[model samples]
Target: MTADTAKNFGPAFKTNWWARAGWLAGFLYAAYAANYLDVSWARFLQGLGNGAAFLAEMVPPNFSRWELLAANLIETVEIAIIASAFGILFSLPVGLLAARNLMPSWITWPFRAFIALCRSFHPVIFAILFVKAVGFGPLAGILTLIFASIGFIGKLFTEAIEEISLKPLEALRAAGAPFMSVIIYAVLPQVLNRFIGFSSYQLDANLRNSTMVGIVGAGGIGGTLFAAFQRFDYDFLAAILISIIALVMLSEFISTRIKRVFQ
Candidate 1:
């Protein structure tokens, strides 16, 4: 090879023996763990047969309880809508406050802390807690999803605000605009599109999670579906699963349309 080619290829071709050894050790450890856990080909074959039987039982979904299914679906949608609305509304102020470039340390720290706390727990866990506190219903689901949305969108929104062009804000300040006016004129324009994107994404995520929170008795079709599974009502479970799929697809389509319109 030419001198330049050899020089360029030298570093690229250099192997890290330590890293390769570590990977080999990890593979050996995984095998040890599998043996310790008693995982074997016999277990794998048994699982496959069980899975096949389960699939066979789920064929020919029952739609006789369409009305009940529809009602649960509606409730799930309501929970998503209400939670998303509140989350978006509340996130705006908190996100703005948490933006380090915009707000003082006193203001930013508390809001950042709150966002962190909200994000620390999963929505399903939050739903369970809320249900325990408020009793079983969609209210718990709504609150859980709201917290989830706040944690996600609020953090992103604050970062977006912080990264904005300060030149426009400086111009607004020089123009003798009040803080709120500066935010409206300088800050809003830069982050509004991103805020829209975040909100839409949160809405989509909340719709999917709302269905899941119900498995914990927070409320929604998941609760009914879980009950059906316990009773071996696979036909009903199949129907519910189909409806959920349709709902998610429809929501995804709507969210895409909304994003396009705003864009």
Candidate 2:
């Protein structure tokens, strides 16, 4: 090799010894941790056997509880719809405020913090808190899911807003348009499709989570399913699980239609 090339390259590119050692240490520690956790082949076999028995019992789902299931399903849908609607509406303003490229740091920071706070808890945990604050019902579930949706879509919407083309926005400002008018003409056009996408995605997620919030007595099929499980009614639990899967799939279809329509 030339002297110049050797000087530029320094020593021959040897792998870092520490990095190789770290990998080996990590692998060994993972094995040790697994052993410490008692995750043995015997435990795996026992779990598999239990799972097989559970599946066998669930083969014939009990649709006899159709009336109860239907009622809870409707409640879950209502919670999802209400939560999604409110969440989207509220997130619009919050997301706009949180977009650092659109707003000053002082304005964006607090809004971003609020979004972070909203996103910090899972829907089920939020549902429990809401239930404690507001009592058990669809109302608690709705509130919990609303917070969840806002956390999700608000952050996405803010990022979309931040990434929007500034050319149009600058032109609007150069023309002496007010902030609101500039937002209407410049910001909205660029981000509206993305906003629709985020909203639809949140709605689909909310539908699935709404059903689960009921496990904490916030209201929905989850409560019924949990009760059935406690009673060892695997057939009924299986039926509920099937219905939830169907519901989520249907919601996904509807969300796709909405996205296409908006796009």
Model 2 / residue 251 / CA error / Å: 1.2
- Clashing residue pairs for model 2: none
Per-model CA lDDT versus the true structure: 0.94, 0.93
* Candidate 2, 1-263: lDDT as tens digits: 68998899887987799999999999999889989998888999999999999999998998997999999999999999999999999999999999999999999999899999999878888888999999999999999988998899999999999899999999999999999999999999999998989999999999999989989999888899899999999999899999999999999998889888987
Q: Over the stretch 1-263, how does candidate 1's per-residue lDDT look in tens digits?
A: 68898787776667889999999999999999999999988999999999888888888889999999999999999999999999999999999999999988999999999999999998988998999999999999999998999999999999999899999999989889999999999999999999999999999999999888999999988899899999999888999999999999999999999999999
Off by over 4 Å in 2: 1-29
Minimum summed lDDT over a 10-residue window in model 2 is located at 6-15
Task: Provide the lDDT at 214 for model 2.
Answer: 89
Worst 10 residues of 1 by lDDT: 5-14
Segments in model 1 whose C-alpha atoms lie over 4 Å from true places: 1-26, 32-40
Count of backbone collisions in candidate 2: 0
